[model samples]
Target: MVSDRIRILFNRIAPVYDQLNTWLSLGQHRIWKQMAVKWSGATVGDSCLDVCCGSGDLALLLAEQVGLPGHVTGLDFATAQLAIAAQRAQARYPKPPLTWLEGDALALPFPDNHFDAITMGYGLRNVTDIPGSLKELYRVLKPSAKAAILDFHRPSNAQIRTLQQWYLEAIVVPAAKQFGLTEEYAYIAPSLDRFPTGTEQITLARQAGFATATHYPIAGGTMGVLVVMKG
Candidate 1:
């Protein structure tokens, strides 16, 4: 039920998702995504997966890292988002080794030890089952493979947390209001409040059976990347 609501919300915002992201993040999202990809440790000709790949930003980044002969599967629950991702790929690469699929994060549809590397951008917070999702990621990753999961986070610093809340309520929500998405964007604050901290995430990752888990705080704790490896 919760997943359905989130899926519908994403589908509704698919058209303006990228544009709003660019505006909201002041174009820093691209750099953050690149950092996630690099941390993913995806190499040339490697099989990669981007879970909850929303419009394919991380997936496209992974595609570039894993060039020809490498395959990238972008999985998202919203068909509209997947459609946009496919369209974007077609325009950018003549024969980009990319495939977009509509799927769920908690139960990824792939074999064990399948992908060389995996990435998820702004996705971990939205998943209904964080630990389960992490387990699925660990299952699909090859031995010694890494998965980089990136998302918004609640800053541990009090001052930064206040600023983040201010930005969300003041700048983000208002801008989203202009696009008739005030409610959609407003959920971010509460979600962040409910999201696990970097330390908690590391604990969860280990519990999910990852061999090693590291949570790197980014953007002054407003963002983070949880890099987990399979044994």
Candidate 2:
């Protein structure tokens, strides 16, 4: 079933997304995003896209890489989030000009083999069809183009799972309560539960016809990055 619930939720939380991300991740989200963008291997003059670009952080970083000639696009289904992203781009002046598009990740708006590289941050868990979304990402990327996607991970170790649950219920919930988004913030735990593990993600990437797929677990397995290379 195609549901608008996630879109609605993002629209409702768009204003606080960046701030909360920083708080929740203890300012480490930026580094993770940096690593994901780096893993994409988006060099100078490369066309890149940041899928589910909540506030254009990753897209802005990508623009820095693509420099003068290259261009980057930020795509998201949530209009409110896109508005915020556009505002950020305007205020920060992310060079190379950014194109913010309101669209679905499972159905990208670009032509096949168009983008040289892609990056996504904290988005894979929310999509309804993970495999379909991955397929679309693989489709739009040019041959040999790379993608790096960063998202929350469900720790396979029991102790780590306990830590994750505690952090979400204690730190995350309390922080989001200030914005009256307790219920919305609570979705993270369940989303992690549904998210594929690092190993499984690589297999899914292979199934999507990518020539290479690898998952790098980071932050003690609480976070992971799925890196892929198009054949």
Clashes of each: 0, 0
Question: Each prediction's Cα RMSD?
Answer: 0.7, 1.1
lDDT tens digits by residue: candidate 2, 1-231: 434988889999989999998988889999999999999999999899999998899999999988968999999999999999898788874344689999999999989999999999989889998999899999999999999999998888899989989999999989999999998899888888888999999999999999999999899899999999999
Which runs of model 2 end up more than 4 angstroms from their true locations? none
Candidate closest to the true structure, highest TM-score: 1
Estimate candidate 1's alpha-carbon lDDT, on a 0 to 1 scale.
0.94
Report the Cα lDDT for residue 46, model 2: 89
TM-score of each: 0.99, 0.97
Clashing pairs in 2: none
Give lDDT tens digits, candidate 1, residues 1-231: 999999999998999999999999999999999999999999999999999999999999999999987999999999999999999999984578999998999889899999999999989999999989999999999999999989998888999999999999999999999999999999999999899999999999999999999999999989999999999
Model 2 scores what on Cα lDDT? Answer: 0.92
